[model samples]
Target: METHKSLSPDPNPAAEDDDHPAARRIHRLALHLNPPQGLHSHGDLRMLACAAKGKQLDVSTQELTEYMRGKHRDVQERVYEYFNSRPDLQTPIEISKDEHRELCMRQLLGLVREAGIRPFRYVAEDPFKYFAIAEAVGSVDMSLGIKMGVQYSLWGGSVINLGTKKHRDKYFEGIDNLEYPGCFAMTELHHGSNVQGLQTTATFDPLTDEFVIDTPNDGAIKWWIGNAAVHGKFATVFAKLLLPTHDIKGIADMGVHAFIVPIRDLKTHKTLPGIEINDCGHKVGLNGVDNGALRFRSVRIPRDNLLNRFGDVSRDGKYTSSLPSINKRFAATLGELVGGRVGLGYSSVGVLKIAVTIAIRYSLLRQQFGPPKQPEVSILDYQSHQHKLMPMLASTYAFHFATLHLVEKYSEMKKSHDEQLVGDVHALSAGLKAYVTSFTAKSLSICREACGGHGYAAVNRFGSLRNDHDIFQTFEGDNTVLLQQVAGDLLKQYQQKFQGGTFAVTWNYLRESMNAYLSQPNPVTSRWESEDHLRDPKFQLDAFRYRTSRLLQSAAMRLRKHSKTLGSFGAWNRCLNHLLTLAESHIESVILEKFIEAIKRYILVSALEGGSFAIHKLTEYLSFQVRNIARELVDAFDLPDHVTRAPIGMQSTVEAYSQYTQYAGF
Candidate 1:
């Protein structure tokens, strides 16, 4: 062996140039290792047997679970346990769409009737009650999740939010008890995102004291309506309310309004006269949902069937509404349905939790190629796998909190009916629904890829989970349209900041951000990379806020500049991409702020080696933190075995191999 004294002196080329003592110490470590004259004999280098107990952290997974649960634990746990215990839910998805649909329906009816959990009643009393149930069901099966949403959130929620006391008195009990299986008819073939342009007509009739619901063209047919193909007996149909007039224009278009149109007979379950329904057929995912298309051929609904809370038709065939404009009425109607987006966002976050949990747990159990003469190590020990999963885990935690906040805002808005709060929650829900669902859709595919070939197996759930979640991006509202709505709201706030309009609590950040935007970041901030600085919550928040404000201001300027020549809509069209980027940036800022508010400090950092800077000490500290806290943090997600359902994601290697062998039919 080479003697220490005969070894080369420090290869510290930067030793002379470096000023910091730590920098010099790191440089000297460069010469600390030396190779032997020849490879060591097997006897000399062979591993020694010893008891090396794994280190444990002081973190409590239970406490973290409680934190994640917030005030909704009991409700969620009830729902989670219900599905987990049911052997019916544990079965594979090898069944037909009809079987899947019937199974989903069975699960839904059991939840409501057998479990005696009326999520509909909780819609007004406590929104989290319903939200918790929705999220829990979503984690187990996205198809069942969508079925529940269609039944409870969309159909039941529309009645509660948009209908008057009389309308409620007539339908609420039936909707609550599953006596009325209903679907929402909002998205038409031609106009999904633009509810204002929906072509279906609900013409008032003075003689009959009814409204004639008619699809003017094939494009006006209600498409992708859940529960309509096999189960739904009624629909909360959205159509243009046309009232007969004595003037030049024979009728007045009352924009879009909701009416309870009976799509099927409660007894026979037959499609009603003049109402046509066809199955949307097989989908790329969410096949368990019986999605269908509906076309109305002058379907007659009683005048009382109109959900008259927002806009009403009287016996005299006159259109009456408290909202002053057609636009305000439409806004009010959709505002009530914001709960759909809220529930969707919350459920999407839960789906992501399942994916991240499965991916991380499997990564821990999986062993792959190793260095020469060493045993295979857990995939999670590899930096590539960590990079794939840790950020996703972090974001899931953030989204969990942020989506809960949206629920809170929505609940408060519904109760108070505060106009400003309503606007804030609408925009917030829309942006979050778009951003979170898009992320989950993309992250599912990534999680699939991360697990390698095993992820390809349907039993492992990544393929099915990803496919089911893919539709979340376009349903409720298309992501592109939703983001534009958010950007429009942001610009409205920006203008309000100048027009002397008082900022609501939510938009107040915009005013402060605008002020901060006038000044540039200091040189230190511009070049900030210190470990402490990077981890500081204040620094992270300020950076996000500044980025959002800068985007908002710049996007506004671009629109203004283009408007000089192109006109308003043309200018908006020209700046569409920039506006979308601004919308997403704003949403990211909000999510980051919420996450920072809820979390305590702990993170890892990476750096590229370069000019004589001292980072080794910092790097070592971060490495130790990862080994200490990373595993426990992931464990805190605490997905039940049924939820994960992956062979390699189980607790022990035996369990994994057994499950894999069983799955392989060996």
Candidate 2:
């Protein structure tokens, strides 16, 4: 657990000339920091620079980076160091796909070597540490983050989770050392979510004692595979295992299983015989990942290549699995891949933080309409502007805290093979992944719009943030499809056989609500009528719970009726939208709970520890004035202006403009 320390601002107040803008800015920012013990202002330290230099301030400093980075300051600083050390990984806009891929590959490996971000290392004890490091990569450039994720989290992850001792011995060291560049070839051209529909086949040949793998049709070709176009030499291929009926056999359907298949020569980087790889070409985003489509004609690999963690094939071609049900085995296998989805959730928020940072920084500097007598006001003064950006800012904080919890839970689940824990982690990751990514897409757009024309500029970096994260909605698993899985799992919890976990609690909440509604239904209280209740945590949770329960009940009944009339698929299709709503509501409820918990732990508890009467008083003040304290909540994101990399997003607009003039030779 090596960690880096953040550089503290120089404590000597009088070191710089009083006339110097930077010095003056620091002095003014220090003013708010030391404000009479009890009072805290959520002002951006950067905006203080604007105030010192006699510039109009458009945004409030209340949304401070110190608050956002709170406990993770060390990790966040390390992230900054990693990116700053590798200037090549910084983003403007990538022009060539090949160049993007090469640069990302270099940085991915370099981060591992220099920063000790062991992307390939198995960290069953402290996955949150690994996840935080991975998250920091995204803030620099999403391509680099994604390329690293593909290499370690997906490709190498398959070998680690599914493979036995032989597979680990042969591949783990190589994968960690970058000796083997690999891709996870799971999603086919025709089948993305529908794993059962995959057409690629790995048939046993008893005489050859090898599995002959083939992509039977164009649709079966592995598509959108990262690291496949240029870097990958091997792949963890997921295919239907077609076994001879006469050969000693098990598994009722004998469905999909993972196998390690070498696709290219390590030295020459050339495609092996019977292997055809085609570039997927430029995508809307993530051009750096080298996504490609692979068609296997008759690629043959040894029987020992089967990643035999959950299932195995005997030397005599006997297929044996500890898990009797094919469906259960398939589920356990896919659960191993949930790491990718969890990584994506964290990555999406990392990018969104950048987008919101840029927008907020710019809003603080730019001015528009104001009273005739006064200097034109900062756009942040307007309710409309604050309304547009503040909630998103709050949501970002919420998502980050929620993601931290997800990483912790994921680590806990990995230590054991508890089926319930696995299912819980998988379902929770799927739901959170959908919620965070969908929020990322929408929030980026809102932040972009908040910045007006400047946000559209490539230099501001919203273009990169939006373009890269836009694909995240459909990345590991389509958000809509993933939500359906969550909803389907939730619906199952209503059955008599259902046990309890995080998602199952949503069912319990719903059942209690239904019972209460039947016993004593009352008119709903609106925020207008019950403003005090709006501040109550129980009220918020109950409201969200009611929405989810109502949706789940409606969807379940509709689905049941449809199933009786039509087929199962038709029933599901008809209730798809309702199911999606139910899933989304459930996820939002979880996020809200996680965020409130964070506030209690990080904010309230920390304040109490300080033993300052003022701090305690401030906490009490915040409890009743959420609207006035919105900036404080946003500040909890702890994102600094430097990371935003936009001129308008700097600590001081005047200083930012001065630097621009110097750079442009104006």
TM-score leader: 1
lDDT of 1: 0.78
Candidate 1 stretches with Cα past 4 Å from truth are 1-58, 89-91, 522-529, 600-628
**How close to the true structure is residue 304 of candidate 2, measured as C-alpha lDDT?**
91
lDDT of 2 by residue, 126-209 (tens): 566667767777777788888878888888888888988898899988988888989999999999999878889998888899
Q: Tell me the lDDT of model 2 at 92.
A: 48
- TM-scores for all candidates? 0.88, 0.83
For each candidate in the order shown, give its overall lDDT on alpha carbons: 0.78, 0.73
Model 2 stretches with alpha carbons more than 4 Å out: 1-76, 122-125, 247-253, 497-514, 517-523, 526-529, 604-642, 659-665
The lDDT leader among the candidates is 1
lDDT for model 2: 0.73
lDDT of 1 by residue, 553-617 (tens): 88889999999999999999999999999899889878877776666432222211100111222
